[model samples]
Target: MIDSKQKGMIFNVQKFSVHDGAGIRTLVFLKGCPLRCRWCSNPESQLFKPERAYNPNRCLTAEVCGRCAKACNEGGVTLIDGLICFDRSKCTDCGSCVNACPTGSQTVYGYEMTVGEIIKKVEEDDVFYSRSGGGLTLSGGEALAQPEFSLALLREAKRHRLATAIETCGVYPTEVLAEACKYLDELIFDIKHLDDEKHKKFTGGSNEQILKNIQYVFENFPSLPVTVRTPVIPGFNDTEEEIMAIRRFVPLRDNVQYEVLTYHRLGSPKYGYLGRPYLLGDVKADDDFMRQIRAKLREYQG
Candidate 1:
C-alpha cells in the first residue's frame, strides 16, 4: 500500500475559478473516474495515468529536422507533411516529446502529487480566498474515487481555516462520502438525470447510489451547504421533464440550492488533443433555454 504522503493524482490546479463554486476558488482536479459521461468537459481527468495531448493549432515547424520523433522512445511520433503525426497507441506518456517540441505542440495531462505538495500550492492563494470568501475546491473525474487523499486534503484545508467544497458525482460508497463531508464546508453534487436508466446510459453508472448518498447527506447533515448542478446536455438530458425531475429530488433543506448548467462546446477541442472522437458536436443550449429551465425550477421552490 502506498503511504499517506503518496496519495492522489492531480491533473490540474486551476486557480481563481469563479464559476465552479462560491467566490474566487482554486479547483484541485483529481485524477481517475468511474463514469464515462459522453459530454464530460474535462476528458483529461478521466484517466489515472498521464496521457499525451497534441494541439495541432499550436504546432510550429520551419526547415528544421524531426527532433521530437528522435526524443520519443516508442517511435510513436512521425513527421507527415512537415507536421507532427502522433500515434496514440505506441506512446508511453514519458513527456519526452512534449519537452523536445520547441513550439509546445505536445503536452501531457495528469501528474502524481502528494497532499503536502498540493497544500503548498493552494496556500499561495490564501490572500485571494480570504478576500473573496473562497478556498480550495476538490473536483475531478470523481473526488470520492480517491477517498483517503481527498479526506486528508480537506482536513488540511480546514486546518488552515480555508473554506472547502467538493464537486462530486455521488457514486462512491456511503462511508467514504460521509468521511469526506466531515471536513468540507460545501458539497456540489451533480444530478445528471432523474430516470435511473437514462442516468446509467449516459454516465456509465446507475443513479441508485448517487441518489442514496445525496438523500443521506441532506437528511443527516442539514447544515452542510449543498448545491445540485445538472449539466443540461442536448440529446441526453435537456428536456423540461428531466430538469424538473432533478429539481424534485432536491431535499427540502434550507441550505441547499439547485442549478442548471447549460451545455457548451468548450471541451470539443480537448477531444482532438486527446485523440478521441467528439461525441457532442456543435450542440449547445442557448441562454433563453437555460433561463426557461431556471424559471421552471423556481416552481419547485419550497
Candidate 2:
C-alpha cells in the first residue's frame, strides 16, 4: 500500500500554468536535481537539502530586529554594519532563522509535504482543469530523482482523474523513468545537447544515456505524446548546426514534438540568494534567432 504520509521535498506549486501541457496545469516544483547546468534558472532547486535564503531588501535590519542571529545554532547568522550577513558554511540548514524572522527577510527553500497535502493543493484548480482540460505537472530539479515519491504522487493524481504530465532532464535510470511514464499523460523531456562532450561540459553529465533513453522511452511507449524541449543557451548550443541537429533528431513526424525554449535571466537572482555567482551573466536567446530556429524546425511538417 502507498503510504499516506510519504513525503517529498518541493519548493513551489505554481497554478494555472498554460505552458507545461495541453491546457492550464498545476506545476509542482520538486527540489533536488542531479544535473548542474550552468544556465539553469532555478538554481535553488539543485541542492537536495532544504536551505536558508535571506533577502536584504526584506530584512528589518539588525538594529530593529536581532531575532535571526539569536536563533542561529552554528552562529551562522550575524550582523555586519547594521546589515544581516548569513554565513552559509557555518549553517546547518536547520531553518532556525527562517522561523524566527519577523519581516519575511529570512526564508528557506524546499520543504517536505505528503502526497495528501500536495493533492489537496492540486485539487484547488480542478474547476479550472475541468473547464479548460487542465491538470497537474511534476517538474523539478528532475522529478524522477525522487522516484518513489514521484510515483506515489502521480498515482494519486491519476486517482483524482486529473491529466498528468512530467518535465524531466532525461538523465535518470531508464527503469525509474519508465515506471513514472506509466502515470504520465505527456512527457516533456529536455535534450540539452546532442554531443556527449559538450553535454558533459555544460550539464556535468554525458548525453550518451540521455540520447539512448529518448529512443528507449519513445519505443517503449510509442503511443505516449512526447515533447522534446531544448533551452537555447548563448555560446553553448546556439549555432544553427547544433539546433538543427536537435530539431532533426527529435522526430516531430509522429506523436513526438520539438520546442526551442528561449533563455532568460529570471533565475539569476536565486543564485544570489544562495550566495553563489551567476554563471551565465548577461546571456539571452535572441528573439530573432529563436524565431528562425522555430521556422526551420516547422518546415519538417511540410
Candidate 3:
C-alpha cells in the first residue's frame, strides 16, 4: 500500500465539467486553502484540516434526540438555549457527530486519497477527454496547498499523455510554482484586487505574493497559456478603476488572457451550513452589471 504521507485531502472529484478548462474535463477539488476570501463560493475549502458543517434546517434539535452529543466524545455538541450548538473548539472532527445524526444535518469536508486512486478516476473519462480535447484540471482551496500530492497527480496524468491544468490564486512559493509549471499545460490564476489594502480586507491576504507569482508564470511559462480571473464583486472592485488597475498591471498580450467572472450569491446558503454569517448580506451583481464589466474589459482586450 502507498504510504499515507503522499495522500491528498480531496473534497470532490467532478466529472464532465466544462467551465473548469478547455472542453469536457474531470476536475479534482482539493480541500484546504491559504486565503479566507469573504466572498468565497466554497466556504468548505478554506481550512487545511477536516472540519464539520452543521445544517440547522436538517438538524433534529437535541430536543428531538441527543444522538450527536451522545456520539461525540469530545463534548463538541451542545444544546445552547434550545438550539443545536456545535462547539468547534472542543471538536476533534472525527465525524462521529456526522455519523450519529439521524437527520443528516452534519457533514465533514476533507479526506485522504492517494495519487494512484485519483489517476484511476481520471482515466474513467479518458474517452471523453480524447473526444472533447480535455483531460484533468486540479482545482482547490488552492492546489499548491497540497503541493506534493498535486504534482504527483499531474505527473501521473502526463504519463498517460493527458492534458493537465491548474486553477490557482497565485500566492504560493516561487519554488512550488516552478515545479508545477513543468507539468501544467495551462493555469487559471485569480487576481482579486490590485490595491493591497482592499485585497487584504476582503481575502485576508495581500496581493503582493499573488501578483509576483502571476508575473513569474506569465514570463516563465512562455509556451503555456495563462488566464487571470477576477471575481467582480459589488461595492468592492466593481468599478472601471478597479478593473483597469489589475488589467494594466498584468499585461495580458499573447498566451496570457484576461477574464472577468460575474459574482454569484449562490453560496450564501453555504455560510448557514458552516454556522457563519454571510459577509456580503443581500448584495449581488446583476447580468447588466456583468455585461458592462465585460464590455469595459473588451475595450482593452488584445
Candidate 4:
C-alpha cells in the first residue's frame, strides 16, 4: 500500500527523460545527499530542507517591485543603492518571497510530496510507459538518502505494476540497499573512483562503503541488471588509468555493464541562482577526449 501521508522532500519531477534509464522515463529527483560532489549539477537538491533560488534576469528591480522585500519577515531582502541584495544569513526560506515575486525570479528549491501524490503524477504518463517501456526512475541528490520515502515510492510503484529503477551512489547502509534491490527493476550504480583517498578528496566520502555495497549487490544479485557509470571529470578522474581502475574493479558480466559520461558545465547557471559557485570552472571534455577515454576503456575491458 502506498503511504498517502508519508511525505518526502522533492526538488524536481522531470518527464519524458530518456537518459537515466531504459526507454523514456520520468525522473524523480529527491532532496538530500550524503556525498558532496564538487561538480554536482543539481545544487538545490543537496540540502534536506527548502531553499531559495534567485534568477537575476527574471527579477524586476527593487524600484520596480518591492513585493519580495515586503513579504520577507526576516529582513533578508533589502535594497542597496537602488539594487536588490539578498541576505542569506537572515533568510529562513519561508517561501514568502517566492510567492510574492511577480516574474518567478525568487523560487524555492524543495517541497514535500507523498508517495501517493508522486505516483499519481507518474501515472499520467501511463500510455507512454506502456508503449515505450518506460516507467518511474528515482534519482537524487541520493535516492537512498531518504530511505523510507524512497522505499515507499518503489514499493508503491511496483504494486501498481510499473517498472521501477533507481540511480544511486550506493552511499547508504548495505542492509537498506539489499531491501531496496528487492523492489527494483533496474539499477544504475556509480563507481566514481577506486582509490578511497581520491574519492574522499573529490566527493567528500570514503569509497569503502560504496565499494562494499557494489560488491554486495554484484555477489548477491547476479540476476539483477546493473549499469556501472562513471562521470569523467577533468583534473579528477579523466585519465585512462582512472577509468581502468574502475573497469578492473567491476568487470562486466552477463548482467553487468559499464558506461562513461563526459563532464559538462551545463548546470553552471544554476550555481548563480542558488548563490553557490560552480567549482569546476571552464572545464571542458570535448568529443575527441571522450572518444579516447571510451576507446581505452574498451581495450582495458577486453
Reference-based TM-score of each model: 0.94, 0.94, 0.88, 0.94
lDDT (Cα atoms) of all candidates against the true structure: 0.85, 0.87, 0.84, 0.89
Model 4, span 158-233: residue lDDT tens: 9888888999998989998999999998999999999899999999999899999989999999888899999998
- Give the per-residue lDDT of model 3 (tens digit) for 1-302: 23323689988899999987888999998988889888889888888777688887887787887688788888788777877778878888788889898887888877888988888889998999889999999998988988888888888889879899999987789889889889987888999898899998988898899988887877877878888889898888988888888888877568788888888888778788777888877887877878987888888783
Which candidate do you rate higher for lDDT, 2 or 4? 4
Instruction: Predict model 2's lDDT versus the native.
Output: 0.87
The lDDT leader among the candidates is 4
lDDT of 2 by residue, 97-149 (tens): 98899987889888899998999999988999999888999998888889889
lDDT of 4: 0.89
Ranking by TM-score: 4, 2, 1, 3
Error of 3 at 272 (Å): 2.1
Candidate 4, run of 10 with poorest lDDT:
1-10
Instruction: State the lDDT at 217 in candidate 1.
Output: 93
Q: Please list the Cα RMSD from the true structure of every candidate, rounded to 1 decimal place.
A: 2.0, 1.7, 2.8, 1.7
Q: Can you tell me which runs of candidate 3 are displaced by over 4 Å?
A: 1-5, 58-90, 101-103
Worst 10 residues of 1 by lDDT: 1-10
Worst 10 residues of 3 by lDDT: 1-10
Q: Which residue pairs does candidate 3 place in steric collision?
A: none
